[model samples]
Target: MELQFFLPMIPPTCTHQEKQVSVVTGKPVFYDPPQIKAARSKLTAMLAKHRPERPIKGKGVRLIVKWLFPKGRHQDGEYRITKPDTDNLQKLLKDCMTEVGFWKDDAQVCSEISEKFWAAIPGIWIRVEEI
Candidate 1:
């Protein structure tokens, strides 16, 4: 089965790698900052409406996500090769997808294709399929 959808909103700038760390009780603790928390919340809310009836399982799932940001000085549909690495962006999105029941675990997604672009219409394009 394949699930695909487009979410019309500016993709979050904050990535999962933005997690903050602190020393508490002489131990290291990791936490998300306010901005990161907000990003996650927004992503979760948007993804909730697209959740699959049953979480995808196994290790043969494929996920394709395209992040479209506002076209500032760049041309529409042009690839954004700058900051907020693709892996970091995918991390946060996959986490939210998991939280919203897109899959039993992100590990089930063995094949992934992620890209970022500067677009006239900002949004996220998501495609999930079982291989």
Candidate 2:
């Protein structure tokens, strides 16, 4: 199975690694910051519309994601080489995808390719397939 689509919106830069930790009862407790929660909500809502009729199951699945940010000082199609590393970005995105029933679990994603770019048209391009 293969799924490909583009979500037209400003890609959020918040990452899963942004989780905040606090010492509660002398133990570490982790929580998402407001921005992280907001980012997850936004991505979940956007991804919900694209969920497959049935969630993809089993192993050997591949996920490809392209995050296109607005071209401010950068030229169109230029690679974004700044903060919000791709692994961090994909971690949040895969979590959202798992929540929205895109697959049984993000662990099913055996292969992943993620990129960020400056583009005149800002959005997210995603492709999920069996490999």
Candidate 3:
């Protein structure tokens, strides 16, 4: 017996009304105090140990972590950090670069390193909202 797969059809009117739109006029909010603190702490720890030849540039790992795990409102309507399951994220990044021969023998460009690091992990997402 042969099986057939049918694609679902979406109505034009339904599609048109399903889209969401919003407008706001104001300055963008910055990171929360706790978040900034956590990021700084983590960055400091990483820097103290690694001591890369060049500066990490921009917000460095902390900014990347924030992007990876955004903040959202909780049940009490209070904003909280949506932490990422970075378990072994660092080791995985290093392994990936080594396997790809990008950093097999020595250090690579900071941009390349960051790119490879982010690529190793999938399904990680982050978004920050002001309290």
Candidate 4:
């Protein structure tokens, strides 16, 4: 099946219920599954290749630390990727989706990407403002 993709700039935000207050008070939230999956898959592949031998127990992919760590406390603060990282992932997703003839409107692509990302990265949060 074909999957569509989009590259929308999302603001840095928290996913915890306490932080969700901003998302709740601000704009409507939307998520995309396909694009997210593609992007996440691409990221996973990259991480695996570059960070092979990293421990993966309960805390997702561990690179620097020794032994497995339970996903650390959110109080440690939310994780945010750089713009280049986001752009690289988006390009990879778009290329994959385009091959499957899934490229569509911007909103649809963003939703797919968000959904996939959320599923792949547990505890990670993403908040986007509606256009």
Report the Cα lDDT for residue 60, model 1: 74
Error of 2 at 57 (Å): 1.3
Residues 26-112, model 1: lDDT tens digits: 999999999999999999999999998988776478999999999999999999999889999999999999999988988888999
Candidates in order have lDDT scores of 0.93, 0.92, 0.26, 0.30
Q: What lDDT tens digits, residue by residue, belong to model 2 across residues 1-131? A: 89999999999888888899999999999999999999999999999999999888765789999999999999999999998899999999999999999889889999889999999999999999977
Per-residue accuracy of model 3 over 32-126 as CA lDDT, tens digit each = 25433443344334333333334322321321221121112223223223222232333333333234332223233232211111222222221
Candidate 2 has an lDDT of: 0.92
TM-score per prediction, in order, is: 0.97, 0.96, 0.22, 0.25
The better-scoring model by lDDT among 2 and 3 is 2
Lowest summed lDDT across 10 adjacent residues in model 1 is found at 52-61
Candidate 2 Cα errors over 4 Å, as ranges: none
Model 1: colliding residue pairs: none
**Candidate 1 Cα errors over 4 Å, as ranges:** none
Sorted on TM-score, highest at the top, how do the candidates line up? Answer: 1, 2, 4, 3
Order candidates by lDDT, high to low.
1, 2, 4, 3
Q: Could you report the Cα RMSD, in angstroms, for every candidate shown?
A: 0.8, 0.9, 20.0, 16.7
> Where does candidate 3 have its weakest 10-residue lDDT segment?
7-16
